[model samples]
Target chain A: MLNIIACFKWVVDEADVKIDAKSRALLMERVGYKISDYDRNAIEEAVRLQEQHGGNVVAATVGPSTAKQCLKDALSRGPERADFINDPSFVDLEPEQTAAILATAIKAKEEYDLIICGEGSSDLYAQQVGPALAERLGIPCATCVNKLTLAESKKEIIAERKLDDGMEVVSMPLPALVTVLPDINTPRIPTLKQVLGAAKKPVDNITLNDLGQTYKPCLQTTGILAATMERRRLKFGADEKNILVIIGALLKEGVIA
Target chain B: MNFNLTEEQELVRAGVREFCQKYVEPLAEKVDEEAYFPMETVKKLTEQEWTGIPYPAEYGGAGADYLTYIIVVEELSRACATTGFTLECHTSLASYPLYKFGTEEQKQKYLVPLCKGEMLGSFALTEPGAGTDAGAASTTAVLDGDEYVLNGSKMFISNSPVAGVFIIIAMTDKSKGTKGLSAFIVPGGTPGLKVGEHLNKMGIRGSVTAEVVMKDCRIPKENLLGNEGQGFKIAMMTLDGGRIGIAAQALGIAQAALDESIQYSKERVQFGKPISSFQAIQWMIANMATDVQAARFLTYHAAWCYDQGLPYSKEAAMAKLFASETAARQTNRAIQIHGGIGFIKGHKVERLYRDAKITEIYEGTSEVMRMVISGNLLR
Candidate 1:
């Protein structure tokens, strides 16, 4: 019986984020947050493994108190319980800081056979948290895992890692950490019943004070600028000659290739 | 008063909106083009337990409030009015009455599975001869010992062909007029109960509609819903709730039209400038925006009144009437903004245009709505 924990982040929905052209800044006033896309796969895999084997799946996240909304969103995806580390300081934690907090929460929360995380968050794509978390917990960890299955004896997990060269298979004993790729599984949307059931699921809140980690930033100095797209503002009359010119330009540009 | 949605309500909207965008929106065009019932989406919704929102937890419901129900309807209708129509029929028309008026045994046998989405529920009230005059139902229900034998035919029965359970209105004593009307819980495919072919419609085609013919359709005495003479009151009360559903559907349709129009105005260029810059287009867009907002206020207010246990029949009627008319007008302008493309087939604006018209016709007609409002005020 495996007790699994899926670590996720509530990140701004990029679709709703607007870029300020003049200031080169990202405007987040109208943006809403969602469970990071890759984290969805991690959650699905945890739930899937639990369904296949008899166990419990707990979803854990680090974010502000407003992120309590994520509790229902994640639990609806089939997790039995949730551990939320909600603190104002959690808003902009570096990868290592995030890893330390998650490790502390996991250690304090439950005894787990496996832990899962996305390769990286949608916002940063730093890809550092999963390995750093494993190091913090002193567990063997695998990254870029696209496919995973438990051995028949349920002693260890066999994971298929997706690398640039090709697929690599790795096996490790219990109490391991695996960072999942998006292709690992297509996450299922919570049905009406699942959404309703989420309301009944138990959620525990862990504070920054509970983690007992002194907040210090090892990574310094960051700057962000919005990338702007330049498009030609060419216009032509809707005549046969203009139509031919448009087709010729398209052909020359190999757009019609 | 606190007008902002609660945190939970906001979350429900965000979750349902995401679901609709990912799953419901893509298939909406195909459902309209093929006039398909969207069984897959329906199955998914049922499996997810969305079919039972606003019901109690003990009876297989989500235990969500009525406001959540409105949000679900609004979001679904924004994607496809047919889906909204189908869910409304199930929630308000079919299952709601059973939940409100059914005996404990009836609730156990029917309401539980209905909330669990085991089978689609349908309501049959409109007859060939009776549309607005629900009290004038000619369908007869005769008490024959252990069973009540029904002989009647209903027209424009939504979900008739696909329904697993039905709430049928029949008259036990014609002399008493509307007071004589009674409701029955008739299981679908019962002996002598025939569901006719799917009726082709101009809008909301994705929801199946058909005629229901009952020829000596016999149900046990226990199947009779509410008291013998309370059918008219029950049907009216059911419709009072249903008007909110229809109004929410109309709000969704209008909101979609307004959204499409705004996007189109920004993208569509003419005379070396986007059409949105023109004051003529701006005026139309402005009207549409205001109308959509006003309708939302009316619809949400009615839903709130219902939830608060306030007398909301007049408010619901006004909301339905205004929202449906606004939807018709907004869709018309949405097409104008899209120019020739909006009129052409395969356009979302075109589909919404067709879908918008039915909201005014069904549940309670715009004319009936006015009568309800005026009657309430005059009294």
Candidate 2:
């Protein structure tokens, strides 16, 4: 049986975030957390693989104390259990530090055949954690994987990576990592029974001290500003001349070539 | 006095909210427009094991508390009130009585399948002659040897068209009045049980409502719920719990109306600025928001009381009264905020306005809710 680890991130629900009218600063006071968008795909894929291959799927995440709220949700999606490595200091963790923590936690597990991650977190689309964790673990890593098939007896995984130009097919040995795209699969909405069942699933809460680590951030996040676009308010009559002028304005604004 | 929902409760709400957005919200318009039951969505709900969220797992339920079940109903109603009412009627009106008063044999035979969603359940209490005055019901059940033969016609029965089992109340002793009422578990397809055609309704149209006629319908004596004279008490207690569900449903309808109004106000521009900038529109929205929040607290508190095993008959009545009125008022304001568009067909607010009215009418009327509340207080 193949054992899989799905790594997810608890990010702020962007829908709930409000932008300041004058300063364009993000208002996060009332914001709630959700599993990062693509991370849901990663978890679903892991669970699907486990269901098909007859194995166990454990979900893992690195975040602050509030991130504990995401564990039940993650578990409800189909994980057998979860590993939450939480620290208040993890609030501002960069990609590398996050990857390091994940790698350390995975090493503590008895055995795992595959590790899956989203292409990137929803808040910051820095696609580095999955590959970095794989590098730290010294395993082959695939990025932008939209499809995956496990050949359990052969100890290999066949994956389809979605690239800008075309799809790339690759076969990698077991114990490898793949960061999946959102389109990999439509995540199943956890059923009421599943939500209730999640309460019985085991969760291992490992503090920073439990991992025997001292961490320093090499990268820091500055203030986040909302992206605002000012309307031009250019009025044009419904005529060929005005349409031509609109096209010229669009070209001048670099909106169209 | 913890106002916050428990962790599992919050998770249930979020999960149900997500489920509603994906499955229920998409078909809401079609369900209303065609006045058709969305059986596909019902099957999905059964698949999700949400038909019986509050019951014990031994009976094939999710084993969550009443608050979590309320949350599920609220979220489903927020998307489609019809679907929400369908579940509420099945669980609260039908399955609840059996769970509360049925014999062990009756539970295993009936409640299990209802909880598992293997068979839909319905309650038949209202009749042509009985509305608020349930003691005036003319239906009769005469015990003959090993069976009780039933003869009656129930009116405005929700889920009768699709239900596999029915909790039917009939007069076993006319001299005893309300005490004479008796409840029985009659499986669908029982001899002489006939479900009439679907009734045309202005609100919650997608929920199947029909006439259930029992012409010499016979069920085993073992199917009697509780004692022979306990039907009225069982029904009243069941409705006491069912009021919480209806209150939650009202809260959902109001919340949906508020959401639609807020979104529309921000988008619809007048005087070169969004109408939300105007004090008149802002006042309406503020009132709607306040009312919706208050209704939610009342509804949730009632559900919490039930979960705590506290006496919540009065609380449920109060919540049903306040929340249903709030729903009616907020939906009206929502339509006012939407202006002409809200009156047009296919608009969510229009459908919500139609759906909100029934919350004040069914389960218990607002006037009845007041009577219940005062009756408790004066006692």
Candidate 3:
């Protein structure tokens, strides 16, 4: 049976995101989390391929200790098992650093014929990580893939990658990486039975130290500018005479220009 | 309990807001003015499988909880009330009947597509003289052996012109009063089933409300919804969530107007200072903000109740009554703030002012909502 390993993230569930109005920061207090929507897409693709060609699919995510829900959600959706890199230190990893840590986890396994990942996480949506992790792993990777095929005779997979300008189909040997589009297939929801069963299923918990890096940090950012651009406002007066002044002001500001 | 939204809801807000602003708002006014239905938008949403929110995925719908559906509807309406209304009534008024009562085969054939948004759907309940009192429907469906011959007219029904199929309520046993009413799925262009001219409306014009005339509309007995005598109850139950949609619709219109007004206040100068600096304008904006937020919480709370499978009729009615009226007040203030400019035909606030009032009238009027709320309290 083919073995597929899907890389995923425990992100603030887009469905439950709460933005702090005051600081313009993402809220995290009892703020619910879930497997990133894109990563779920990637994992679902792996599950589909496994069902198609007889394989075992293991889903994995790197997030804080509270990210068990991400692994649980993934496991409930047909992955044989899951990996959650748990630690508070992981609370603020940049995209590149995250890719490195995930690559280390994948390398530690030293197994699996294929690796799949979401095109992007819903939280950041930077469209990084997947390809970056592939680079770190020294494996061939394709992003925005719509089709995945396993050629039994050739012992390889042929995949179709959609690009902004055009499309390309590439053949990757075993131990390859593929990032899938959101439209690839609707991610199946975990039922109550699956939710209960996830507790029994194994979710291998790893930490940042498990990656064997003594010192920490890479690609540090200066800081985030909250509300990068303030929206321009133009109001009209309460009375009819002021309406002309407002219109004239709007016209002068080139708002109506 | 903190009634504020959690993290996932925020993400939903951002994404849905982006979608609505980019897709819906730009075309909203034209849709309302021209009565042009968005077949493309419907097709796009169905393809993305967004048509069915809160319905179980097993039935080919999103299976999101009711709260999630409300959030989406509110966001969609914030961008374009018409788009939200289409999905709201389509699912709540038309498809809910099937999900509540249809057999397995019926669900597979009709419920599946309706939830999938693969086809436009509607509830044919309100006739010319029989809107709030749907039991007064003059439309008659007589049992004609294998097929039921339906001959009645439903007026002011949204999505009629473009609806692929309709969930029609007809009097099968008129002598039995409301108990004798039966519902059916009448496919569009079924020889005698036709959509009448679109009604020109004050706002949310993108949603086409027209008369659905059944001139000997024929359908197999298999298409009968629920038991032979349960249409009115089904109709009432269907509007439970449908009312919430209108409330959210009110919230959306109010939210848009308030957003515009606040932004405008910050920029427009008065007494050699930004109008936002004035206490009076700030007070108006503050009240508008609080009212919109309160209405949102009420609507969302009712939606959450539905998700928990609890009784939410009273909460739903309360939300509808408060939100719609609040929205009208806010929109009226929005126009007042903008003065003569807001009174223009094209300004967002003017459109909002017009749009806000409909929420009070449709699904259930404020008085009707009060009755529903007060009536539920008695029960």
Candidate 4:
């Protein structure tokens, strides 16, 4: 049976993030954290695979110590156990730093036949950690995977990558990495028994000291401001001439394309 | 002294909320409209061991406390009151009696499956002639050597159509009045046990209720729930626990009404601003929230008392009285907040309004609750 690891991130629930009108900074008071959206798809895919093919699914995540909450949530979604990398310093880690830390932590824990990740974190959508971690671990990686299947011999992973123009079919050898899109599958809401089972599942919480890894951010964000859209309150009568003018303006602005 | 939920309790809420939103809420309207019992969802609930929330793990239950049962009932009712009604009845009314009074063999035969979700249970204590006066049951059970022949009719029995196990109360001795009554374990398909057509209900339409007619229905002497003369006491004891479940159900309905009102107030625009900005709407919302919280505390406290093995009849009565009335009032105000739109059929508020009234009437009526509370205090 395949031994797979599903990676996840805990992100602020964006719905609760309010914008300070004057400072344009996010108001994070009373905010809650949830497993990153697409990361749930990654976990769900892992669970589905385990259900179809007898295997062990372990959920792994790297975040602040508070991110321990993600372990129960992931395990509830059908994983057998969880491996949590908790470090306060990882809160603002750049994608490369996150990948390095996760690779180190995962390697220290156990060998896995496959590693699944969301295409990117919901907050940053960096699309870097999966491929970067794969590179560090020297395993082939696939991104934007919409459909995936394991070979009968379990030596290869066949993935359908969703691209801008068309879908690309690619196969990576066993012990590979694949970052999935949200469309990979709709994550199931864990049933009551599954949730209770999660409480009993083992969670291995690893710290930076446990991993014995050191990472430094290579990219820095100076600031972030909320984007505001201003709608033009244009009033036009039911006339052909006005409509045509509106269409022309839309065409010039590339809004119609 | 701790008001905060334990991590396990919180997990129960989170897990149930997610499940109800996906499985129960979507079917609420369709069930109400078509008057269809949701067997699939019920099966799913059984699979999750929710049917046995407050029972023991050895009996194939979740081994959860009464408070956990309250939480499960509250959350389930919040999404669909009918489902809440059915679940609470099955847990508190049908299964409780067997669990509390049945012998080890009886527990093994009935309570185990009831808690395991393998079989659904119903309490057939209510009769046309005996609504609040449960001791007035005309149903007679004659001792016939090895079997007791049951003959009577019961009205307004919840889960009668779907339940495989029934906790039936019948008179074993007429001179004993309430004391002569006895409860029995009658499994479905027992000859002479007939389930009548489903009665159309104002609310909780999805939970099947019907008349159960027993014409010479015979069961082995071993099927007796408790001693022959202990039926009224058993019924009263069962209703004491049953009231808390109904209270939780009412609290859930009231909470849903308040929640809908809050959401509606924000989205509904009036006089160039949201209705929520109006002081009048704000006042309604505030009052509704207070009532819901009060009902919740009452329900939870009663459930807690039961969990601690304390005398909780008065508390349960108080909780049911307050919570059921709160539901009725809150649903009315919820409808008022929605105005004409709320009165329209198929509207969530309208359904809630209709559903709220039954809480005041069933299990124990508000008047019965008052009597129970006052009588206990006077005693």
Error of 3 at B112 (Å): 2.3
For model 4, the docking class works out as acceptable
lDDT of 3 by residue, A1-257 (tens): 67888888777755555567578775557666666787878888888888888878888777778655465567767888887776877776777878888888888974888889888887778878888888998988888898888886647889898888888999988778888998788766443234435657877778877777832676666765345555568666699899899889879878897
List fnat, each candidate.
0.56, 0.93, 0.00, 0.41
Candidate 3 chain B: worst-modelled 10 consecutive residues by lDDT: B6-15
Q: Which ranges in model 2 have alpha carbons more than 4 Å from their true place? A: A235-251
Best by TM-score: 2
Candidate 4, superposed: residue stretches over 4 Å from native: A15-27, A218-229, A248-257
Listed in order, each prediction's TM-score against the native is 0.92, 0.97, 0.72, 0.94
lDDT comparison, 1 vs 3, better candidate: 1
Per-residue C-alpha lDDT of model 3 across residues B1-379, encoded as one tens digit per residue: 7776644444445446656666677787776667667767666556545677767877777766677667777877777778888878887887788888889999889888888777878888888989888778888988899999999788898888888888999999989889989888888779888788888887877788898888887899898888888998888888887888788888888898899998888888978999889999989999999999899889988888888789988989999999999989999999888888899887788888877888989887888898997787787
Best by lDDT: 2
**Sliding window of 10 residues with minimal summed lDDT for model 2 chain B:** B7-16
Q: How does the DockQ of candidate 2 come out?
A: 0.82
RMSD of each: 4.2, 1.6, 8.9, 2.3
Clashing pairs in 4: none
Ranking by TM-score: 2, 4, 1, 3
Candidate 1, pairs of clashing residues? A191-B48, A192-B48, A192-B50, A193-B48, A193-B49
Residue-by-residue lDDT tens digits, candidate 1, A1-257? 89999999999889898888599998989998889999999999999999999899999998888778888889989999999888976777788888988888888867999999999999998999999999999999999999999998798999999999999999999999999999999888776557667888999889988887766779875877888876666677898899988888788878896
Candidate 4 global CA lDDT score? 0.90
